[model samples]
Target chain A: MKYVNLVVIFSLLTFFACTSSDSDYQVSDIPGGYMPGDTARDFQLKNVNGKMVSLANYENAKGYIVIFTCNTCPYAAMYEERIIELHKKFADKGYPVIAINPNDESEEPGDSYDEMIVQAKEKGYRFPYVQDKTQEITKAYGATNTPHVYVLNKDRKVVYIGSIDNNARDAESADKFYVEDAIKALENNKTPEISKTKAIGCTIKWAS
Target chain B: MIKPMKNVNLVVVFSILTFAACTSSDGDYQGSGTAGKHVVGDTARDFQSEKVIKFPELQEYITTSTDDKVKVINFWATWCAPCIKELPFIDSLRYTYDPDKVEVLLVSLDFPDQLSKVNKLLQRKKLSSTVWLLDESDPNLYIDKVDPSWTGALPATLLVRNSTDQRIFLGKELTKAELETHINKLLN
Candidate 1:
């Protein structure tokens, strides 16, 4: 009986040690984050409207444009209009936008849930603007930067992961519409030519 | 019963090894780029200077003489909070060491249109280091061009010694002591 207890305790300790946040490593050093073609896990996160929103709720959705963004980051702010435009373009085509704020309130007070409500209202966000309070979904998706995007097909397989476009500085000047191209490929039942790209973005303020 | 106990001990040992490997595997996470592209020991790309420096001439600017001095290039922006917090210590590096021993370059990743914001911060900070605003427009092209390991995060630093072609890329903000240790390593 004593030996059984020891075994159980050791197993539990090891599990938590691996799962616990190790913040020292660079964002890329984070292990087991979702890559293109990998299946993404569904999540039930709270929207600014105080309702739980999950991908399962969208039965008609051919896919989802899940973005990990926050109100505080300037980079995120730059893409806010673009994100709205993304929803407007693709929502009717069966891909709805789901915006999640991954920043902790303590680290960035502007990213708090209440602030999200204000921003959503002010921006007249047509899509579900959610908050990942626990950040489990954010960690599961391995989002390092504000406005990080992951496009998942109906099968929940991530087809694209990157910035919304090549130019975060200016939307009108952006030549590469990465997310749009990916969704367009999916609509045509073809593989996206480009699956991944990177851009300079604010680091998500993780709870220390 | 005794056999099961031995198995448990073995499992524990294996788990500990796995945990240790995860913690120390920073070097193992190499960039997924082609070989010899922006990795350490290779010449780093030149920054977007205020004067719009092109290549060949820009190469001369980034590559210091084999005078054994370490060049510290820090990538930051005016909007990034942590980058602003660490600017003072990074700026102090200029005063801490003789110009012949260490050189600090502050590269602003701010958009070309936001040049005024970058200048405002520089003026307020009274930074003595040379400042350059990145002239590049698209990040997807420049991010990997800068370093394969870079995920386009702010507060990234690159320490290089031109003489030996030795370089270290730190992807996070550094304390003054930590910065000195890396510079000392290159200097020695």
Candidate 2:
């Protein structure tokens, strides 16, 4: 009798304790290129000013710092100022920061193109902050998180792929600046020592 | 003769197993992770205490693989949408496999302030699986240790099977079918 009661109680507990939470996480069916030696696929994204921006837009750059970031994620917001600083410090050196928000607006309303424009204007963004229309740009790069950085060379080879640095919360306290170090290495005609460092960041909101 | 209560228990357990077999969908997780130190690797058989473990100890489980059981370490957070999306499926793995063959370590990466939220969610979800807090603050010190393929994403899963030297590292979230396939490979 006791065992029967326990089983009944446990069954009810399982039903009450577990179920769905209405999370609509989407993954792209198309395979992506993420390995270090792969060439990047050229993608066109709409900038905040209603202009189509692609790799050709920055013809003067020696390489590119393609950062996949969004407005809604707290981690992305934390790196906002530092990302601005990255542009300020590296753009002149031919390594410009191109920010892309690949989130689906229906699921992540805060990351919609309209909200992106507002964020760019309010943040005084000096670089191109664009929106991935179909999130194909995100999938082509195999981008998994917001603020995921892929440093590309003149030939569009993914030279450095990973986080901006080891620390996301407190930039000042950061010990290893992965993105900065990669750029600085490229400047000296050397490879970034730590080519890939996978740190945590916000998952890119994929379109359902 | 088995009592009616015993029969009920058997029925419920079998039903749970069936529920575990169905349902599929998973994803990749990327975000900041914290750390701490505990020697969980040394004590896989003793993981039922529900005591919070630090990062180093968890690594011990990975590095040592002392007990030779297949270890499925899932890195997730309470607030992550994808992480929550696949929680039940990940939790279901527990009921599907015998404990002797599989040890599921659910490492929650919630911020220190969000511990209560994690507790509540675990309770509400009825995740009776083994849960741990990745008490590490430094990513550089331990990210590679988890799996070199991971880029710090949530809903990420790592399967470690020492006997076959097989490690399935899915940096993204997984469907139940995908997860089961990996587990079956390890089991085989």
Candidate 1: interface RMSD in Å?
Answer: 15.5
Candidate 1 per-residue lDDT, tens place, B40-122, comes to 55322221223322233333545657577788888898888899998989988877888898988788777554543564466
DockQ of each: 0.23, 0.18
Clashes of each: 0, 32
Which lDDT tens digits does candidate 2 get at residues A103-202?
8998899888999999999999999999997988888888877778899887788888888877776677788888888888888878888777666866
TM-score of every prediction relative to native: 0.77, 0.71
lDDT for model 1, on a 0 to 1 scale?
A: 0.75
Worst 10 residues of 2 chain A by lDDT: A20-29
In the predicted model 1, the residue pairs found to clash are: none
Candidate number of the best DockQ: 1
List candidate 2 stretches off by more than 4 Å. A1-41, A92-94, A106-109, A153-157, B1-54, B66-68, B163-166
Docking class of 2: incorrect
- Candidate 1: stretches off by over 4 Å: A1-29, B1-66
